[model samples]
Target: MNAAYAQSSVTLYGVIDPDIVFVNNAQTGRSGGQLTGKQQYSMLDGTTSAYFGSRFGFRGVEDLGGGMSAIFTLENGFNAANGTLGQGGLLFGRQAFVGLSSASTGRVTLGRQYSSLWDFVSPLAIITQWAGYIGSHPDDLDNIGGTNRENSSVKYTTPVWNGVSADAMYSMGGVSGNFAQNQVWSVGVGYTGGPVRLGVAFVDAFDPNISMFGATATAGGVTTNNLGSLGSATTAQRNPVIAGYASAHRQQIFGAGGSYAIGHATLGVVYTNTRFVGLGGNSGPNPFGYSGSSTITNVEANVGYQVAPAVTLGAAYTFTKDDGPNNQGARYQQVTAGAHYLLSKRTDIYMVAAYQRASGTNSLGQAAVASVAGLTPSARNQQVVDTIGIAHRF
Candidate 1:
């Protein structure tokens, strides 16, 4: 390059993860054929192991003088297996935001960004660390895995104050006449002191189908029409755990979690509650004919040990329960184990396995089926997955 900027700097960063996976008791033939139960073996691009997803991006910072700076990030998520875009094909779907920061104050940003839960509480969740995608809390009902993002939003984060920090976000509903039709808001707080880390967060969305899960490439890109069909708004998700409740008039999530580190080993635990209220005809077909509300509660505990300088082992167990209208209840239990070996500073090899069992009535008002996030739903009440992968960053 010929140009030079003295007070500005930009850096390029990316991660690529590819894995071979095995799934059992999965349903197949969704493209117009007899859907049958079968075992599947395939290669996945990213988001299964090592990292959340395969992505590349440019992040830059410009000194504005007096300990202030202008900052921005543009990230793109892509499938390493097929070389296609992830996150609904948006060029910078993973994250795209610009903001100003101050050393004494905080920072404010606008554009597509993460929710406070994603920023604060998610880090303490096992699914975000080593539990893998399949280890998500029964379809990631509370979004602790950050399966969704907020669009057309403004976010504020506070500078750490005596081992504590906080953030908040608000997303515009964008409806001309209905100011709260699809609006979303969230808040979170975190604390870090010595070997202890703690976090808590809460999020509420009006018409979550449109304001949250609907913000995808195939889902019409974050609309304000609460009257739209839920199926159309949540086409990106196949997990039935919460899909049936997408048409709910409101959705709320609360999560609190923390981790404690002792030498080379760490122990973590998290609890989350998610609610879908006012389920009725505001959207499309109510498959289960749900008329009232539904609630899901989850708890997870995990431990990780650094066996060696370059080797780590982790395991987690999660329990989830759902209570819906008409006294329907579903329950799920899962266990996950994984190990990662660092080949180099920027590359690693990993193996992970997870198994889950389900019972009772699911949100669809049918027999509960095991459905791990990022994989096909099981034909029965039990499912298993194993993955071997390699991840690299640059």
Candidate 2:
């Protein structure tokens, strides 16, 4: 093999993280399926790690003469404890995309993929950094954690110019006779200069339950055509933050974030606005009896510090509020703190904790309850979680 022809390569990578966790005010069912609150302790996989989820992936690149290349990525999410597929049990559910790239031009990709908001703006959000899964806003309604992905999508990214870049994505509805049904689109712009980074993004989707938030694909590369399983008021484990609006016909999200580094410390702030429009209009049962539109706002600030070469610390605060039809709403406040110590290049030990408080009315038309993104909603208005974990990468 000549050296010139050896420009193609494929790489394998993965991460595994396991944790012992404690949660207070967890809701559980009693003997007769009665709902009651209790404190629980358990071992979980990846949810408390610095990366948020455990995953394995393969990425490849092939040179195509000039300054262009062919690229592809197949990533899988899994639960380390149970050896089961993550992301609703779909293989390669984290990401699966193939595309072409040019040094002077840009890149375009197709397949199941993340939205522009996740790619560009989330980097500055606390959840993308040390805050990890426990820091998500309410039910992660804004998709800041990449929990929601688009199917049957096409994406384009521009080459960086003087530390500035932009990208756009569109997901086809794939429905006969109705091109706009289940459609999703997004756009974002980012800037990186010195120790400062900033981004802004917007997303719009029709029938969001099927297009983005609830989109599900199979191992055979087929996506679900209808709204998947939905949460209802009677569902003991369902999050109350935004469950009532599950039948929303459309959804819009806009967000902006920035980070500034001052030597060993970095400060970040983010804000997002989300709207669930035309509820009770989708092709699913409206169990929560929601109508019209509901609006949500989230604001967060965080700081990370490198106290030593192998030690890092982080803290964050977030406030989320929802304004629904006829002024119905809920409010949430959360605080998180974490510490990490690197044991080696590919391993680390960490501890993270968070507490949340809620008030007003939840989407279930009942009293608001605290709920973290990965955990079940609490039986009361306050909840607390603590976790200690170890992570390894290869």
Candidate 3:
């Protein structure tokens, strides 16, 4: 082991991933208007997070003696194609945390970081670690709805014993009057031995709401305002915030996953269930009283085979089903396959293809909302995307 500042070390690490992509049934413009209909198209890349999501980070560790050490990491996510922050313009959108660790005790960290759900289950699901196009759930429901990464959080991890370990985290709301609003909590355990690894976790989110508009009006036969609609209705519903208070809502997530290695092949499987319940009155347009409950279940599987010391072939699939009040139920499925060739231990090239299909009833029963341009209730739509990219880590 390297000693503290006596042997202090600082390293710069980053990955620059950019990919060219082809999509079928892609809307043309950012406006929901019908600029271009379903057709094959090609682009510079990053359909999902822009290939490698260019990022730079600094990580270091210092020995504090007596079996204790101090560690820190500061990472930022950016769009390589456009040179911009990745997560809603947050500077350290990916992660920013500092912590202390003990060889005999455990580790404690604080800051914006990935939640237990992602830390535990994502490894088993090829999509989360790779990209949204392949492993992502329909609309990223599994990852985001369960609070993929949190802000203002404190986390703890137990020292591994015989390949078994545990972790827990709690997030502060940062709100004055309401202590629980927008807070989050999570706990998990994992075990890895020989050729098998398994983990389980649970997470809860107080309130989280985000939105994105469609590019075109009728790419998947669903018509909506070119700028996308916002409200407490339909799939765009968000938790309501009090007049002078913060939003009040809650989410619970439970997941389990495992992976096994066999010869030169590895296989992984994961299952997650998330529940959301509204706590406040409708802040946006309350077409159906606003307060509602929803549950989402996700299952994913992956397989990877090492073709050579520097090459790997993999395939993955994910299924998601949403059930809720006000005709908000929907089903989403995705299939992905890809391959990677390592240029070195810290660099690689990859090619991946993905297909997504969605079927369900619209939240608005009448389907007459101007946002949805004559979109039929309970329709099925599909999208196909292919990507080729390279990533390097240092």
Say which candidate scores most in lDDT: 2
- Candidate 1, residues 1-394: lDDT per residue as tens digits? 6985549999999999888889987774333322246898988876467587789999999998888899999999888989998877889988999999997999999989999998888888777787557667887788888878888999999999999999999999999999998899999999999999999999998888778887332432222331122334422225567767756888899999999999999999999999888887463346556778888999999999999999999999999999976768799999999998999999988888999999998776667789787777776889999988899999
lDDT of 2 by residue, 1-394 (tens): 6565638999999999888889987876333434467898988887666788789999999999889999999999998877999888879889999999997899999998999999888899777777677878887878888878888899999999999999999999999999989999999999999999999999998987667756333221112221122222243545567666667888899999999999999999999999988988863346667788989999999999999999999999999989975477999999999998999989989999999999998776767889887776687899999999999999
Q: Taking the tens digit of each residue's C-alpha lDDT, what string does model 3 give over 1-394?
A: 9854544566788877666666554433322422223444443323332133567899988877888888888887776766867655668767899999897899999997777776677667765444433445554444532224677889999999999998899988777997876678889899999999998998877654311111122211112231132332123211111111111255677889999999999889889897656724221223334356667788888888889998878887777776645445666677878877889987777887777666663233222111111111111256667677777666
Give the lDDT of residue 60 in candidate 3. 85
TM-score of each: 0.92, 0.92, 0.80
Clashes of each: 0, 0, 9
Q: Please list the residue runs of candidate 1 whose C-alpha ends up more than 4 Å from where it truly belongs after superposition.
A: 1-6, 29-35, 215-237, 281-284
What global local distance difference test value does model 3 have?
A: 0.59
Clashing pairs in 1: none
TM-score of 2: 0.92
Candidate lDDT (C-alpha), each? 0.81, 0.82, 0.59
